[model samples]
Target: MPVIRVEMFKGRTVDQKRQLVKELTDAFIRTCGGTPESVQIVITDVAKEDWGGAGILMSDKYPDKK
Candidate 1:
């Protein structure tokens, strides 16, 4: 089994996530020769306040976004 973890700011729609997982599974199967059913994908959605970059909170860094 192959496990894939993706962490990103929370705002993506269900369709986007579905497409991402499908494409990821396809790529893994093509490169690693694994069944799509055996591939595990975990997506972690974090709020801008919970994530930090460049020593600053993302929410504070980009106040224009929600």
Candidate 2:
């Protein structure tokens, strides 16, 4: 089984997530030679306040992004 984990800032629509998983599964199967049924993916959505970079919280770093 191939387990894939993805973490990104939240706010993506459901359709976008669906497309992401489908494309990811297809790419994994094409390159890694795994069946779609055997592929597992986990998506984690983090808020800007919960994620930090450059010694500053993302919320503060990119307030305009919110």
Candidate 3:
């Protein structure tokens, strides 16, 4: 069994996440020789405020411009 975990900033649509998992499953099966049924994927959506880079929170670094 292969378990894949992806963590990223939130805001992706459901369709995008669906496609991403499907493609990831396919790639894992192709290269790792595992069945789709045996593949597991976990997606974690992190808030910008909770994520940081260069000693700055993502929320502060990339504020919503409106």
Number of the top lDDT candidate: 3
Show the lowest summed lDDT stretch of 10 residues, model 1: 57-66
lDDT of 2 by residue, 7-41 (tens): 98998999999999999999999998968999999
Ranking of models by lDDT: 3, 1, 2
Candidate 3: where are CA atoms >4 Å away? none
Model 1: lDDT equals 0.93
**lDDT value, candidate 3, whole model:** 0.94
lDDT of 3 by residue, 1-66 (tens): 778999998999999999999999999999989689999999999999999899999999989779
Q: Which stretches of candidate 2 lie over 4 Å from their true place?
A: 64-66
TM-scores of the models, in the order given: 0.91, 0.92, 0.92
Q: Give the true-structure RMSD of model 3.
A: 0.9
The TM-score measured for candidate 3 stands at 0.92
Taking the tens digit of each residue's C-alpha lDDT, what string does model 1 give over 1-66? 889999998989999999999999999999989799999999999999998988999999877534
